[model samples]
Target chain A: MSLPNPSFAPIDWERATPATLLERIAEAKIVGMGGAGFPTAEKISLTRKHPPNIVIANGMETDPDVNADRVLLEQHLNEVLTGLRIVARILSAVHSYVVTSHKKTIQVAQGCLNDNETVRYLKPTFQNGAERELIQILTGHVVKDNRFPAFDGYLVLNVHTLFAVAEAIAGKPLTKRLVTVHDETRWIDIATPVESILESSDPIRVGCYATGHRPRVNEVLTATVNAISTDKSVHALPCIHCGWCDEACPRDVPVESLFVMAEQLKPNLDAQDALNRCNDCGACVVACPSNIHLLDHVRALRQRNDIEWERISRATQARLRVDAREQRMRSDVIRSDTKRTERMQQQHKWQ
Target chain B: MAVTDRPKFQTTGIMVHVVIALLPGLGVGAWFLGHKVFLVVLVSILAAVATEAIGTRSVQTLRDGTAVVTGMLIGLCLPPSVAIWVPFVASVSAIALGKLVFGGLGKNLFNPAMVGYALVLIAFPMQLVYLDGLTGATALDVLKHQETESLQQLINHPAFGLVGAKHFEWMNLAFLVGGLYLVLLRIVPWLLPLSVLLGIAVPALVFLPLYDATYSFGSPWFHLFAGGTMLTAFFIATDPVTSPSAKLPQIIYGFFVGSVAFFIRCFGTWADGFVFAILLANAFLPLLEPKKVALDN
Candidate 1:
């Protein structure tokens, strides 16, 4: 698949002033477009107050059937390099990395870099794709629960997200999304327009398919299309203590306890010990075959615990008021009954 | 207009919707079974409502009007020529034993109507299932007895024999229309009905091609129309508390039920497979949860 006119262009990589970088990102509204859809400009601006010494481009498409980031790395290597360089320059980071798992994609991206200074490739395993896990692989520090990589001057962005950031620096808004349509039944591979993908055919559905509204092709299919992922909000079944999800997680994280604790009352959930310990990595949610949105459940549990604590405190106050009112009513009833009996006795005596 | 914020498990609404939905079936039943079905249905509804009212008042609670609906459904499920007292006992058992003893209403584990039918089934199997010559034996009953009669011979019943089988056909239509209404109203998810319908249809269609000298597939249409399938797909099996909470799982649950009901009717212990299949699905629904994925942030 070679193009006749393949004159490649080089991207300018320089440490721009914070104001210039902010202007570039805001002009494009390129918040983190790839992963969570956070505004890229805003994230970059936040880095101005707290400078980062390292920038990592996330080219790992670890989601089982998703390949948006990997696709961009293979075909748009030069553009990706330029975007990674711009991101590094904006943050004024000394060490920059382009992380990926696909050997071909990494090789192509390396070819585009052409032995450029300050650009290196870090091969990622399944565990290394995680933001914190990648940080651990790069610099021997495993980010425990509650701690963020920004604290250690490390910021990771998906390759597509970085490309979007570069486009944002060039003043473009997000009007399109990359969708991977993998047909489980037919084995068809596609990277079609979002609308076309939505309208195409029925694929394997998961997640939100159970409880949320059924999605039509008319809707924007953001992620990959397969039985592995659903377009609807997921409904959780009551955990039957199989402990399979915990055992399956590669990170050795106990997703089942988190799910159980989220649904039922646990001693340590409310204490700082539990609340501050989440690493924000999605192993539990991924490892679960029940399609239980575990991290979402944990967040719900945290909110519920706060409400429960408040409710208990309010109930205690309410009980005291109820006791006083009941006592007053009992006394009044006794007084009235005595008067009624006396009147009845006097009337009967006369008769 | 905004969509009504109906409760997820609107047990009363479900019951009411079903009764209102059953009007066509009730009318057809009355027309074929004579005025007896009408009387039985009315009495069943009245007895059910009255019993529920008494139960509520005794407990000092406001009635939700669901018991009457259950009674009417039970009446709909029974033979028209049944004694008047039969429905009273059935309704009582449905509410008292099937429901209230289990903590009432949404707390019941089995379909209330099926529970009532089960009581009648065990206690008065003869009176409950037998109907002079007008009603004849049910299709499944014939299958269960393994009469070894040809399809042509089986269709010759005075009530159900092919030529004048209008009652059987009409009864199935009425139930189907009511079931469709429930689906259109979105009271029940489309998957359950569709899957069950397929569950019954797929095997029946296959067996129709393979139907031979020893075993008959019966009428596939008869299988869908006869017995409690319409009631089960739209009402009993759709019990939100007992059924799978999710749509995909619900569909799987429904398909398994329909398939089992068909199997039981064709090859297993009974002609009617609704109660047995539903109970079986209830036991295995926990194992069908869709696998969830963790997002790598």
Candidate 2:
């Protein structure tokens, strides 16, 4: 299960201080490779403020179609572990864990684990891939209800992000990443034009098919891109009202009603709550018998909600400005009237 | 990395499955009622498709196959002895007035088949007479007309079969099989059919024992197996467009339809009241569906 050659030259651990490591990560501009794209340096710094108790390397690829993390774990086990140790050292974390469900991935990771490091296996599911959910699984603490894992003295980094961190420490800028395109996992350079990878005229999805966006043709691969795919058009049909989407949703979000609301463009407040709760995991789409692109509807509804929010905010700002101006003008007029009356009174007393 | 949509099931596939499940019932209906049932079904289907295509000005909707389903359902509800033109008119009305007028397909509030059936029932009552006048009474008609006869005597009547009304019981059995297949496929929700049966059976069970020689009512088995009970409960009443989609609402809606239909059959004047019962439930769908209620508030 281990990689054939773990001959990666060891990082100069004795010479590299936490400050220097943080500086290098910030300079490389490495962000979360888990697709959130939050800067790794900032996340480390935030966790360092509280001196995290644990650092978890998230290798759980819950998206059934995406295998970039699994492949990275298999191919670059040493580099991923080095990155995990580096983060642990910088955050002054007491214990570090590599979280994965894949047996081979865990075995490879276990061969390279240090004294403070442990391998934790979690059964892969869509919810387990989420940072909050992963923290809950590993620590038995629900961070999602109130605060983030980092706020609770835990730092969770994606395995791919740790790989990028290792490369950044080895003096490579954040550039190339493993991306699964057309079911083949390969190292794709960042900023590679999507058109170069897309071989067909099919719609280009910028991530896994389930949660990926239909990227414009001119878009380029980025540090966060885990998978790219050409759209295989599902022969979609009208909804049969089967309610499988409702059953499949992890958050119990009432996806069937959300679909109807999204289609009709008449989403209510309850639908808004469903939209917020949706993680866009695409499980509902997978469960749908009609092949409805349910995530697309969810995204569309969210975008519409965002636009509506923006409009209301803009209108409120404009009204506030007008009211402030009107008050100022009224004050100015009253001052002028008082001065005129005082001057007339003075003239009358002199006469 | 194969970027196909997650779920591979197509809406057309569901419709195709539903149509396949219905074949057994159609076959039974044809055997008992003769080839005219097929003719009526064919005419209704063609008329419905034509109305949808011409009214909506879109031929692509035919691929979805809902029009075909609506047409077939309307045709099945018709009396085998009904004039061919009656189904044609009903099919056209079912698609145009019942469906298209409500903005077509998923937008419609009423079950198109039930709407068309109710329209034709009111307009052509005399022409809707069944079985070539051989029995002169359907099971519901017999139950409604019963006076000074015991339940046993009613069962021994010429219109009555061992299980239910003559020839109708076999058709009902075929439909029950088809409906179960639909439920197994998960195309139709099980709650609707189960609740509908309970809705009818519970009431009939409580009422049948009260039957005296002066007021004869059919047994629960006879009611369940009788004319249009299985067909309406499984096929017509469970139409997604008209029926409530959420679990609790769907159960309540099914129960309401079944109970009202039974009440109409036992005490009301209609020979079979499924059409009216379904229509009445359809009217309550917005109130029953949790989503619609949330939206209104």
Candidate 3:
């Protein structure tokens, strides 16, 4: 119920060295809690080679309908900003930003920003939280789809990661976070049994209804998970082919076609290519008038495609092995012929 | 628990609304045709529900209310003077042969209502027509038989109204109101219905000059208001399950149905062209949205 102040002391920025701060961040074992769960230490470690880098605290909270970031920013605004400053110091960031979709979070962030730091709000849309999308929105610079923003002198950290960084600087590891369980928002301990979060016979989504997956058996709460939605699952009705899912899709994926393929349980190469464009934003799930859980079908299609990928790769490898062996045998036959001709010539000379 | 983001209606909800919209049209059809219209509609609904219940043997499938809509559409498409056995046959064929045989509801290739109507229309053409039986007797039939009348004399005929067929004009207005309600709810795509109306009207206007004043094929307004033109445009042709989903595809599909219906009404043997027009359009569906392995974009 209480904010985890634990006798909080403001960081002495003048005395904090970049190497030591990075070590403290590493010691905390903090991670991006905005669904990806990427290790913060490893992420920041890569951005060191490129200077004049920008640091952004991603309070955007792209996990559809999840309130973890909003609540965290509301209660722990100082800590989140402190974590951002701590990351900024490590790389001597030229500029720092606190980006969020929540109106109140942006207002709170703006009130406490330093000279080099700025805060802005984005009109929340599906995939607005993705790295490339965020980069495109804020900087007006389109990053190549194949490349990562971190490699291009950008450091985007989830607000929860920043909060953990602040706590890490205060000599605490990331052990707990604000999680939305059903409708309740509170600090949940990492590794708590997921079943304990909500008591529903229906399948539970580990994040929000839009983007969360059904937890595996005995799955526990992790830093990446910000919500545990239960009692939301329902039987999918037949696809009326209304194209609502396609309209809702931020990536413009042909979700109805993909869903049809998924239902047939057939592997399709075209579906595989289309899946690459889909970020699994769950917009389609929200848009379906038939209450079809399109994300489930999308995931099913993904699994099918993955299996198809393995089969294709394995066949290619087998063909390559056979071709190499044939080439080696031909080369060996040529070598033996040359040796025989040399031996015959030597015998003729002796005669 | 579902985050109904944009006022989403489930399949059952959509079907319920469709049934609601059909009521006004049903009432008007019954008022114009006679008490037999009520009996025919009731028989069709009961038969369709019974067939569906027996076919699937599931109460849950019955709850979706699609059978009811199909029954209503088929009932409205038929003449009120048809024999009692006719509605039963149409309903049975609609549910069994038209819908369930193709794997039920959403998987149906053609509009179930049109399939049943077309079947009965072809099988017992005399029963469907009953031309001389009733005084009002459908405007299209009256228009077909009146070849010697001049344009001015045709307008004075009891079968001809200001713009449309005599009794059918009011019936068309009722159906239009119901359709507009559906469009307001956004259940039926507006573009599809609009395109169909334009499809029929544009050609009728173009062919207005070619009319021999002495020969009667009726005016463009008569064609628009008579028979099942509005019904097919708004309700039958716009059936989302049988129709294309995208805007462009819907436009093309609607236009094809409308133009074909116009041609058939003008030249074919049938009094109304919608039943065959819609079925022909259904056969062309795969071309509009080909089920290719890859749907680029």
Q: Write the per-residue lDDT of candidate 3 for residues B1-297, one digit (tens) a residue.
A: 223335667778988988888888888877767878888899999999999999999867887788998998888888888888998999999999999998887888888998888899999998887453445555677666764467677777777777888777888988899999989988888899998998888888887777676575667787789888788888998887788878898889888888898888878888888888889989988889865123434
Q: Write the per-residue lDDT of candidate 3 for residues A253-285, one digit (tens) a residue.
A: 988888878877777787776898888778888
Question: What order do candidates take by DockQ, descending?
Answer: 3, 2, 1
Full-model lDDT for every candidate: 0.62, 0.82, 0.81
TM-score between candidate 2 chain A and the true chain A: 0.88
Candidate 2 per-residue C-alpha lDDT over B4-75 given as tens digits, one digit per residue, 9 for 90 to 100: 223345677777877887889999999988888899999999999999999978898788888899899988
Candidate 2: stretches off by over 4 Å: A1-10, A13-15, A101-124, A144-146, A171-174, A232-243, A254-272, A328-351, B1-8, B56-58, B132-136, B161-163, B290-297
The residue-by-residue lDDT of candidate 2 on A1-351, one tens digit each, is: 223333333346547898988887887788898888999899888888776468989898876488899889889889899898888878778988898877887776677677888898777766777888877777787776556677778888999899888887775565588999888999988899977886876666788777778887579998888889765435566665666777777788888777777876753544577788888877777677666788988888888888887887999999999999999999999999999999999999999
Among all windows of 10 consecutive residues in model 3 chain B, the one with the lowest summed lDDT is B1-10
Candidates, ranked, TM-score: 3, 2, 1
Least accurate 10 contiguous residues by lDDT in model 3 chain A = A1-10
Writing each residue's lDDT as its tens digit, candidate 1 over A60-131 gives 655545555666666667767777778777777767778776778755555555333233445433355667
Q: Write the per-residue lDDT of candidate 1 for residues B1-297, one digit (tens) a residue.
A: 001122232234455776788888889878877888887778777777666667656532224456766787888878876888888888878777777776665455666767887788678766676474666776567656657656666666443534224366677678789888887876666777778877887888778767567666766776776677777777767765466545577778888989899988877755577777877776675476422211122
Candidate 1: fraction of native contacts reproduced: 0.00
Please estimate how well model 3 matches the true structure, expressed as its whole-model Cα lDDT: 0.81
TM-score of each: 0.47, 0.86, 0.91
iRMSD values, candidates in order: 15.0, 4.9, 4.2
What is the DockQ of the complex in model 1? 0.01
